[model samples]
Target: MGHTTSTSVSARGRSTVPLLLVALVWSTSAVMASAQAPTSLAPAGWDAGIKLSEARDRNPDPSIVEIDLTARLADVEVAPGKIVKAWTYDGGLPGPLIRAHVGDRVIVHFTNHLPQPTTIHWHGVRVPIEMDGVPDISQPEVKGGDIFTYDFIVRDAGLYWYHPHVMSAAQVGSGLYGALLVEDPADAVGVIDEITLVLSDIGFDSKGVLESADSGGPAGMVFGREGNYILVNGKVMPTLRARSGAPQRWRIVNAAKSRYFLLDLEGQPFYVIGADGGLQERPETTETLLITPGERADVIVTPRGSSGGTLTLRAQLYNRGYGSVEYRNVEDVLTIAFSDQPTLPVQTLPAVHRDIAAPKVAGATRVDVVLTLPPAGADGKSEFRVNGVPFWKAKPYMATVGETQLWTVKNESKFAHPFHLHGFFFLPLDEKLEPIHPMAWKDTLNVPIDGTIRFLVVFDERPGMWMFHCHILDHADGGLMGHVHLGPR
Candidate 1:
């Protein structure tokens, strides 16, 4: 229970509405100007029926969440009659959900029971370097039977996650990952029926055996291996019971190794309110939400139709690169089964927004990073490069603490790459080097094939080595990774 004040939400030219208003409006219909529904929007078991198993908090302190996490091998059933020996955290696929409040201290006592050495990378979190979980850069790898402790403060209210930083492509694809949600008590998104969806995939043989990480070799590495099975919270086409026309807040995380989840709700619009770092300046609506690897989206969707009818959440084909969508078909991610109640009238949503200022870039230092894929060598192995060299042969980029830098990343390769920066959030820049509208902090952005992305970031007082790489685990493992040395001012 750290008493840190959060600036993620701001009341600018509008009233600061709290979540309690939702209950009040639904119960009495006093404060809202929209059509009222039954006090119980969802059935008794509907809200908690389709959710990931949560990690039990051991700490009694209201502000500190402590949990023990073990990485081991477990037999998880992704689909009926199909079970695979998957590498997992806490012996479960997609691991247990870790929930904490904004600015709360989280302590994870981790033990590695798996065969290989591994470390847990807190994705999209603003942790100190020592807790970053990148082997050899921030901390050493935790070998088999070894124990480690991760202690950090949740500075931002958003959906983050954790996974193995060592052998990420193999480990994460084998089911070694979980979700970390940091919530703000003052968040104005008044919807209470919220669910956190972890989107991922895994491949297995016909007899339910896990696929090899090196199954495709060089060609597989070039295109990034995708699982044959799509998963939402470790289940195949799991069904959720929802009330018709009742808004449900969805915090979605794309945890796939390389797959991009371009989600569509039968052409129905999704009200996107937040992203990787937290709530944006304002909400936007889109018929489809593209959540790339390692990305998260906070959105609201109202499932509507005849009672007892179901609506499917489908993952449409997205062209990440060549062959990504050549013969692929749409994937059914989740099935929302509506309750037997009649559809309620459409209600007007509250205008919930955040106040985030664009980073000043007038005197920011500029850095250029070119992503390229060279031809296979005599060994017939493909490798991705940054600035014309692989991470192994490249020098560390230098930056001083308290300095702001504008990075222009140009992808000259034939494939798309989800560029990710560790330990900091950046503001995506437009052509004028100015922050994009509906300003929101981001830790990862998708760089399309032969495309470019620019962003402005400042290295704060924390000085240590930080990593930057492609979120596509295969590409990163193939050498499209680098580090930055943030020297003390």
Candidate 2:
């Protein structure tokens, strides 16, 4: 963060790593100088394209890492030749990556300079009640030119993110999200080349203008906002260099309003090691991994092939609940090039993370939740409902602290929705009401159309009201969001 902003830009003809990517670098020297801010080793006023090594150094001591961020309106290039107006954090496409250790203390100094009120919700982190950032529930909205400090202990280690809670659909859609990595102490060096890919679907208007909208129609209301362009770290077709036969860790996040990413690498199988909460006991191999909105997947891949062999990262396109399908050479987010350098050894992992027991709903209370869509209006606008009613500003249910509850969610809607619950992770149940991943933890999951999902969660986190909503930002903004109060019985 020392006024040195660098980016790895790989053009069509340029195969070598370029030193200076002037276009990707946004100058914050003036802002720092104007504010007379003090310098620190933490990632304050940093860029999104920070190198892996520099990023790791910024959080050498997680116990005292101070991540400074600000929200403001700016115009930046989202695509190669596309310039769009956006509300951004530190004037970057996606905000700077905040890295720390599991036991570290994360202090976020958030400043809002936008036209409206806003707050940063530390997505998926089990922070304190006050640090949750939900307006009127945890804390009031930080008004324009105002500042708020969110300090909390980093509980779990994994891929997570941060974005505004108020007007989340508009704010997050305008490019205000970024990734968070809390490292596990057991991970050894020479393990793998770790990288982060913040996947987003940037929506542009008919006249090529960026706006916070879900198309204002029945389909959008039902399906949430889906973008035409798929971007990885704010670029299209970015070349990601990987050593041949070397194990590399790819931490991927889907920070879109609605689009679900069905990820697959050509000729390479994904060895998923972790999910939204953290690393699994061992790697789970799969050809196709469905990463819904607000979910994360930590994958280890080794491209074993000749030099210059291109491994493209493609997302299979589907008309959610419809009939149409598209595949093969779709939007390419990352092009994995097997470099000529010698490959390193595969990474080593611990026996297992601390014992995370299965969700025991044997005698736990059962709660039934249903998802449905109200009939379309005259203008073809539909209202997405959770239980025959759009979400009002109130807690629908009061959860008992430290108590286990079995919740069954049925999707009677026309399309699939990524179900996300804040504050705690749950073990999803199978058709027979059994623990699916009794050990592995996840905060966000997808609920298929005309289907059902049941999970048992032990609400052991701090007593407070937490959000449970569709990860599709538009759906949440369109009154498909609610709060669950977790307090002492």
lDDT of 1 by residue, 425-481 (tens): 888998877778877788999999989999998887778999999999999999999
Mind giving the per-residue lDDT tens digits that candidate 2 earns over 60-101?
452557867888877767655677777788877688888876
* Candidate 2 worst ten-residue window by lDDT: 26-35
Cα lDDT for residue 150, candidate 2? 87
List lDDT for all candidates, in order.
0.86, 0.70
Q: How high is the lDDT of residue 401 in model 1?
A: 87
Residue 111 lDDT in candidate 2: 93
Q: What is the TM-score of each candidate against the true structure?
A: 0.93, 0.83
Which 10 consecutive residues of model 1 have the lowest summed lDDT?
A: 7-16
lDDT, candidate 1, at 369: 98
- Clashing pairs for model 1 are 1-63
Using lDDT as the measure, the top candidate is 1
